[model samples]
Target: MPLVALVVAALAIGFEQLIQWKYGPMGIIAFIALTIGLKAKNTAISGLGAIILVMLLAQSN
Candidate 1:
């Protein structure tokens, strides 16, 4: 159980860093928009999240 917990925690940290690197700075904005869209079931907000995420990715490359 302890070993599993350690692995899970490490995986979580790795995923967090991966997302940060993948999203760059606007990751926070996209995350917020995604959360709002999910909670409110709003397509417009979801679209905004997609747009923001795409824009950030495009800028990176």
Candidate 2:
């Protein structure tokens, strides 16, 4: 499931890049993806998603 995790993580990153921000739907999706990944026992997915999510939230006003 590492591959799947990577894919999901990639999608989150793509969404962040697509919207050019992570404060809206992009952030929400990333968080959801993280939750799903962790729940599925894919630490890689959770790690990657958390990194992006943290970055996004940290930068938020």
Per-candidate count of clashing residue pairs (backbone under 3 Å): 0, 0
The C-alpha RMSD of each candidate to the native structure, in angstroms, is 3.8, 8.8
Which whole-number lDDT from 0 to 100 does residue 56 have in model 2? 84
Any residue pairs clashing in model 2, and if so which?
Answer: none
Candidate 2 residue lDDT tens string, 1-61: 9999999999967865664453777677677778788899999888877887888878875
Please report the candidate that would top TM-score against the real structure.
1
Question: Largest lDDT belongs to which candidate?
Answer: 1
Error of 1 at 55 (Å): 0.3
TM-score to native of every candidate shown: 0.57, 0.55
Candidate 1 per-residue lDDT over residues 1-61, each given as its tens digit? 9999999989967865776777765776686687689789999998898788788878879
lDDT of 2 at 18: 61
For the record, the alpha-carbon RMSD of candidate 2 to the native fold, in angstroms, is: 8.8
Q: What lDDT does each candidate get?
A: 0.79, 0.77
Sequence-dependent TM-score of model 1: 0.57
